[model samples]
Target: MNHEHKISNWDLIKNGLFGENTIFRMAISLCPAIAVTTSLKNGFLMGAAVLFVQTMVNITVSLLRNFINPRIRIPVFMLIISGWVSVTDMTMAAFAREAYRQMGLYIQLIVAFASILARAEMFANKNKVVPSMFDGIGMGLGFMFALVVISFFRELLGRGTIWGYEIVATKPLLIMLLPTGGFFAVGILMAFFNWIDIRFYGGKGAGGAGGH
Candidate 1:
């Protein structure tokens, strides 16, 4: 692994949360973002699962970076990711059985999330432990935040509910609960954030180096 740029821990966190947000900014992991985000409860649990796995994988990879051969780093990263994803899967299955029933496979699928591997390779492997941890937190939080936002709107507008609790007598937009609406939600949110990035932040999309 190659050492990348050095920045304050806070900056790394902000970068993961905003500059390189996995869904809204970096545009990664849209499968879960769409499939599991039809409801707020689903979205939150899925995001939580990813957050744990992503953070742990980053820490593990950073710890073993020097020991891993560059030629085999990808396989090593996958192994590390699968190990953590399994932990997340079983933990959720044990404690959050109902939600786990709905998203169990997706939880297992976290092992394949490109964002996790990207972070391990591009940021964590090249950074120190504390910084890598913060980076993981940032990225995980950003991903969770994006899912929460999308699912909030999706659940609210589509089902007239929040986290499965009814808030209205009638459904607002049924389509929002469907895959087409998932694309609509992701696209709209992505553009909205992109506009914010350009209008206020002078715009730098989360590039390959910025995302994980």
Candidate 2:
């Protein structure tokens, strides 16, 4: 039905933040969502990096979509993704060296993120530059929101702190700091978000775990 044409820019943004959240809703890119979310600071940093790279990569891919050969689009996408990641890495290293040192690995890891590549293939490659940019912003912000929510709970419960400031004064759930705790936190929150979608928004529930 070509529903994409009917979707507005604001809806696109909302879709990323809620409809197809990279974590709770879409369930793609769980690795970083879980691994780096042990603390709010780390999660926020990773989210910010992904947001930048995702938006830039979408813009670049949209601009170059027609020029890219169909048979080699995957490779071209990889190149674009890596290129953006490298630029982000270098910029952060130069201007925010200390912070970059902590998040550099995660930023580089964005090169391999399925969500980014999926956007290039599924949305950016087929859309105009302006729409692509907005889509990227929506998706990036969605991912960032998910990370913040997950890390908020994880850090607060796991470490008794939020962004290093003591909140509870005692680790209410030490396991929340561990990998197992990450799974539990994500699962519980995923279900919570799903419930909200279904009950309030009449959403069908999260779609399959992929770029879409």
Candidate 3:
């Protein structure tokens, strides 16, 4: 879709949140999504870090799009992404020490996220600054939303708690906190979202994970 020419700003936001969600729809960056989502606290912290890096990277990429050489654009994008990721890393280290201790690795991992890099190449590089900023917000929020949903179920089912607060008297499914459980959660949620798309939005369904 030619989002720059045809789609409205609000639609771009919705598109990222639902139509092209990072987890349930796009399926990119599943590694971090699954890894950090075993706990609600980790999931939220990682999502927040990603949100900051993604928005800043998009804004930086959009501003530098014209000046970047086509042959070196990929490297330039990585530089921009890493720069933002480092900023987040140091900022959190100084301010949010406890959270940084929990999520420092994932924050650094944001530099390699396919979804963030894809937006820089596909959307931000071609779109104007304002739209790119909103697109970043949308994509970041979509990712954060996915992490929250997955972590919500995982934590509640596995530990019977939400953010370390007790909910159920007993663990509903202990395996839900394991890595294998992450796969199950992602798969089930992916299907659920695809069903929603087909049933309500008349969508063909979720596309392959590799494509944008």
Candidate 4:
């Protein structure tokens, strides 16, 4: 009776992985997806951090949904998410000191990313705990896919390497690793996705405009 709609776990995974890819589809978490993806390692690290934070927060929020007052849900969600991020920060500092140093403020900045909050408000708030967990994984994967691709390009042409493993022996573009390069990479990728959506997926699109 509870799962009357009968949404299977596999169905959920498919939804997140492809049907609702965070970048080319859902388009929910773009800020970090674009800003932090300077290298393959950075992109992967950021994505893993987001996955952990999102999954934990989603489950926690879903369990507390009934207790959380609607009037203060946003603030409550922010506090809970921040708690997980703090924990993650400390864990990273303990084991991966170098990554923790490299990540710096961005690691903590995950607290403010709208995507996590969006999950709490939209999916986790109403869904059961298990579904909420799946939602988080799906959304995080979508976000990761977007970030990895962008970082892949940025690290390659911008630096002539993939995640610091040198593929090209040249001096590289240099500019691709800069802030301006992030903008260029994201803009070009955005255009490419939009074109694909229009040409193939009908452009109904996800998220705000620009076809996500």
Candidate 5:
């Protein structure tokens, strides 16, 4: 059998969004996905913010990779990421004060999100600017996709709404809004995705803690 090795941008993006998703498939970054996805809107906004952060950080990190020393690469990466996040934090505070307030410390916590760091160290550190940027877009979409999935279910069942728009009318599954419920909701979804992978892909899918 002849081996074929061809990769396209679409494949990369799709892999990041679905095949290698940080939430369902990879199971990484569930904390933010679960914590902030109280509503569909909140989940969307959080995803947007993360997407912006990831793209900028990836580009910048890739640009500076050669300049950073191995001994202090992590700290340097943190500084760069935190600086960008601070800018984003301030921008949000100034323009979207309500959202800023809604996000609170979580916005600041973006600097420490392992997803961003992982991209910096793994992909951005070695890849060129364009590829790093694409990676950011892919990973960001994946992260957002996961958040939206979890939030969609949580909102519909927990509040009878989607993106604050009334969908189902009932008392609602109030537990979905609580912290414990977040875990259960996301866990069940993850298991389902895994099960699907096992059935269709022979159990060979991208396996990791999802997020480091």
Candidate 6:
């Protein structure tokens, strides 16, 4: 049986949402997770941008897969990824200027995102266009989901605020806004999710994840 035929689109999406989330499970693309996730808004916007780029890249690559020569696939993939990232970069710059100013470079850096390129090479290149698109959506959503969770805690705990609205009138935990705090937050969350996987999902940490 063909893999694509056996797998439903929703299963493909669910796989990315929980089974093999890029940041939480695959552990790739931590730079943005740490660098841009100090605030919920930044994190969510970053995730949204990546989601769009990843989806477009996957669909484009899958559509062009047969035409791409095997020997030149890597460079071709980079070109595709970069093209989509540039589109995303320009769109964000035009619509969300302040956010673009804050994490603009990071958005450009999405051209080099492992999750996007990895999906292009691993799943998208081998799959049909619709399946590849869903895979991209799932993985992108997973990445966004991870960033949202990470940023939510970092902002709430560090700034005593959510989305720039002050909730607590006390001194915030300054460390949570720093890179050190990012690591701590990711570790604790990773461990918590790992516990959930082991206890109920019967997962073996990252090894049994759905990315592969």
Q: What range of 10 consecutive residues in model 3 has the weakest lDDT sum?
A: 203-212
Task: Tell me which residue pairs clash in candidate 3.
Answer: none
Residue 103 in candidate 2, Cα distance off native in Å:
3.2
lDDT scores in order? 0.87, 0.88, 0.88, 0.80, 0.81, 0.91
lDDT assessment of candidate 1: 0.87
lDDT of candidate 3 vs native?
0.88
Q: Quote the positional error of residue 65 for candidate 3 in Å.
A: 0.8
Q: In model 4, which residue pairs have backbone atoms overlapping below 3 Å?
A: none
The TM-score, computed over Cα atoms with residue i paired to residue i, of candidate 6 is 0.96
Winner on lDDT (4 vs 5): 5
In candidate 1, stretches whose alpha carbon ends up further than 4 angstroms from where it belongs are: 1-5, 204-212
Superposed Cα deviation of residue 160, candidate 2 (Å): 0.8
Q: By lDDT, who's the top model here?
A: 6
| Prediction 3 TM-score vs. true | 0.94
Clashing pairs in 1: 115-212, 118-212, 119-212
Give candidate 4 regions above 4 Å deviation. Answer: 1-6, 26-28, 203-212
Model 3: number of clashes?
0
Measured over all alpha carbons after superposition, the RMSD of each candidate to the real structure, in angstroms, is 2.4, 2.1, 2.1, 3.0, 3.7, 1.5
Estimate, for each residue in 171-198, the C-alpha lDDT of model 5 and write its tens digit. Answer: 3889999988799888888888778776
Residue 43 in model 2: shift from native, Å?
A: 0.8
Q: How far is candidate 4 from the true structure (C-alpha RMSD, Å)?
A: 3.0
Q: Which tens-of-lDDT digit does each residue in 1-212 have in candidate 4? A: 25612777667666666666766665556777767888888898888888889889999999999999999999999999999999988888898787778885788999998888888898889888998898888877767777888899998988788878889998488888788888788778877876776679776544434322
TM-score of every prediction relative to native: 0.93, 0.93, 0.94, 0.87, 0.89, 0.96
Quote the lDDT for 85 in model 2: 92
In angstroms, the error of model 3 at 47 is: 1.2
Residue-level lDDT tens digits of model 3 in 19-124: 7898888789999988899899889888888888888888999898899998999999999999999998999899989877877888888989999999999989
